[model samples]
Target: MARSVRWVTGAKTQWTIHGEQLVDENRHIRLSTADVELPDGTRFTQYVARMPRCAMTLVFNDQQQVLLMYRHRFIIDQWVWELPGGYVDGVEDIAAAAAREVEEETGWRPRSMEHLATFQPAIGSVDQPQQVYLARGADRTDTAPDVNEAEKLDWFTLPEAATMIERGEIVGAATVVAVYRALTLAP
Candidate 1:
């Protein structure tokens, strides 16, 4: 049985933290385990990921094709497609981070940027908020993908990208979400 604890938010007492402990942590991710009780006194344990927020971009060229990166994610032991993005540095602006990622990963700098959406990719366990930006025009930069970053960069039409997702070739969460948003938000 779960016990009640004073919660201090919105005068709503739906959640109570019974106990929590840090399981592991590093520069990139912090994992914690928490025992929580719900309004109905239901208790459960959850492992949470405390990671820095990420910034990603959905950039389209003059042909209305989206840019993407191909990289081999060791975790899945397979190659996957992803967007130009990374964690927001501690002292850098989020939008600036997005632009920096685009330049570093794809050698392109946005002429104008617009916010498409901010989303929590895995709210159930991770609180990593991703800011997706829609970039209208970009110019080539001298920079290139950092060593061990992207294997290659390419562009695909909106429908082709969606088809890639349907084929399980585009498996990145940020890529999938940003592509969906671009298709709906722009088209």
Candidate 2:
């Protein structure tokens, strides 16, 4: 029988965490193991990961096309299309980080960034909070994009982006969410 904890009160279906111990931690992520008890008295240990918040932008042009980066994610070992983004630096404003990532990764400076949504990419095991922004316009900067960030930058219509997502070409959660949001705003 699972002993009821004082912290959980209302919902009988709610899983309660009895204890958690840190496994490893670094600048990117903190990993931990948690002892959890289910509603039916089942108990198990589960791995949990927490990561720094990330900000990404969906930059658009007058043509209603979105700016995207063609990059290789070494972890996935595949080249895919993604929105410009990165982990928010310590104490940095998330919108500012979104704009900065746009300029750094694509050499395009966003005219303005408006918060679209904040979401968790993998709610099951990873606690990575991501912020998505909508930029209706941008200007090409004199500086070149960081070579390490992306191999190329291009613009695609929202419908095209949706197709790409369906085809497994656009895989990043933030990018997919931004595209759907932009599609909702499209004429």
Candidate 3:
């Protein structure tokens, strides 16, 4: 048996989709144009992008520091600090993906991972769901991080991480959410 939760419904504001035409597709994303009708009877075609789900983690150590990756995003052409994460492979469990990303990208195996939150980075035009996890601690392995993953891996105190966010040095949406979540949980 499943429990049902009621939502505030606004039928008049609901938009209807007539059809979606595929623009292009790849293993990473599917692009399409949707024929949509708005509540006021206005119709239009809108570009939509469907991407694979992603998983990220905030891995904390005993010293109250969180592991982070300093890397360059060619798309944005900026070097930033981010939580370890990657796209979840087909049919792979999200939690497992988060753990694998942490170890593969930072050489740190999280002791345990608890789901912190799930969100859409771009709700208007992109369907990319991101899951954020929290790990209290991790152990460093002899394995080195993937060469292309990051320029460096380091730990920052929660305050330092917050400062980075304020400075716009930590810009990924998932990283920002996880850092703020971890800050509230920190003692």
- Measured by TM-score, the strongest candidate is 3
lDDT of 1 by residue, 62-120 (tens): 88888888999998888888789999999899888998889988888988788888999
Model 1 whole-model lDDT (C-alpha atoms): 0.88
Pairs in steric clash, model 2: none
Alpha carbon deviation, residue 2, candidate 2 (Å): 31
Cα lDDT of model 2 by residue, 58-138, tens digit: 998989899999999999999999999999999999999999999999899999989998999899999999999999899
lDDT pick, better of 1 and 3? 3
RMSD of each: 5.4, 5.2, 6.5
lDDT of 3 by residue, 43-105 (tens): 999999999999999998999789999999999999999999999999999999999999999
Regions of candidate 3 where Cα sits further than 4 Å from its true position? 1-12
**What does the lDDT come to for candidate 3?**
0.94
Each candidate's TM vs. the true structure?
A: 0.89, 0.91, 0.92
Q: What range of 10 consecutive residues in model 1 has the weakest lDDT sum?
A: 6-15
lDDT of 3 at 172: 94
- Pairs of colliding residues, candidate 3: none
